[model samples]
Target: MHIELDLNQNDLEALLHHCQSFTPASGDSREDGRLADALQALTEALLEANASQ
Candidate 1:
């Protein structure tokens, strides 16, 4: 699945903050792992976008 979002500085910061704040109990579930991976990917993409700007 592909998703697209157009986030400004504040939006991106909020997203990063939320992702950083998230904690999955025990970190043992498959869904939790997937969410963690997605968050990491999103963070990397956001960093790359900022670097290119």
Candidate 2:
């Protein structure tokens, strides 16, 4: 299944900020790495969404 989100520019920006500033607890390098990858994908999505408007 697919998902959809309806977020305004400010909401998207705030979400991006939170994702960029997130830091998982120490000793969880695997989860931290996954978060980093997700962040990268989210950032790209944010840019693409903005560009489409």
Candidate 3:
């Protein structure tokens, strides 16, 4: 599946903030680690994509 979003600068900033501040509600270390990793990846990708725009 493919998804696309059209976000303004402020919206991008807000989404980035959420990605940075996210904490998994589950106490499982493995699950939390995966979630954190995914968020980090997303943050990096978002920053890179934003910079390229």
Candidate 4:
């Protein structure tokens, strides 16, 4: 299944940047991890909905 992301370019770029900061070798970055988790959950939900169709 495929999913189309409907986010503004700036917001998406910001999110990508935020997630980039959460690397395992980086600083104690739980906050960025939360952001990444939320993004993944949201994407999964969107993709699952399309798969259900």
Candidate 5:
């Protein structure tokens, strides 16, 4: 799924850089942990989408 990001220039740049530098940490929980950590951004996106409705 594609989610459009709503970030300011500096924040977006940082995010882009972070993704570029991101290498997965080892082991099973790593993926889920990352997703859990990322839920804030996803939640924000959902809120934005809902607000626009």
Candidate 6:
């Protein structure tokens, strides 16, 4: 499965902010790991997109 989003600069910023502020519930190591990976990927993608603009 795949998903796509067409986000403007503001939207991307807001998403990054929200992801940065995310806190996983206590004792949920799996979720915490997933969130961390997602945050890293999102940050990288945002940086790459910004650089190409």
Using TM-score, give the best candidate's number: 3
Predicted candidate 1 versus true structure: per-residue lDDT over 24-46, tens digit per residue: 66656998888888888888777
lDDT values for all models? 0.80, 0.80, 0.90, 0.59, 0.61, 0.78
Q: In candidate 4, how many Å is residue 8 off?
A: 15
Summarize candidate 4's per-residue lDDT along 1-53 as a digit string, tens digits: 54567666566666556554544433558865776677676655644554665
Give the number of colliding residue pairs in candidate 5: 0
RMSD versus native structure for model 2: 1.9
lDDT by residue for model 2 over 13-51, one digit each (tens)?
A: 899898778876657899888878878878777778878
TM-score of 6: 0.68
* Per-model TM against the reference: 0.73, 0.75, 0.81, 0.45, 0.42, 0.68
Clash numbers, per candidate: 0, 0, 0, 0, 0, 0
* Alpha-carbon runs more than 4 Å astray in model 1: 1-3, 26-28
TM-score of decoy 5: 0.42
What tens-digit string does per-residue lDDT give for candidate 5 at 1-53? Answer: 68676666567556656654555565768785786567555555655564675
lDDT of 6 by residue, 1-53 (tens): 34467889999889878777777665889988887888788777776777888
| Winner of 2 and 6 under lDDT | 2
Quote the RMSD, in angstroms, for model 1. Answer: 2.3
RMSD of candidates 1 onward, in order = 2.3, 1.9, 1.7, 7.5, 7.8, 2.2
Query: For model 3, what is the alpha-carbon lDDT of residue 14?
Result: 100
- Candidate 5 has its poorest 10 consecutive residues by lDDT at 15-24
How many backbone collisions does model 4 have? Answer: 0
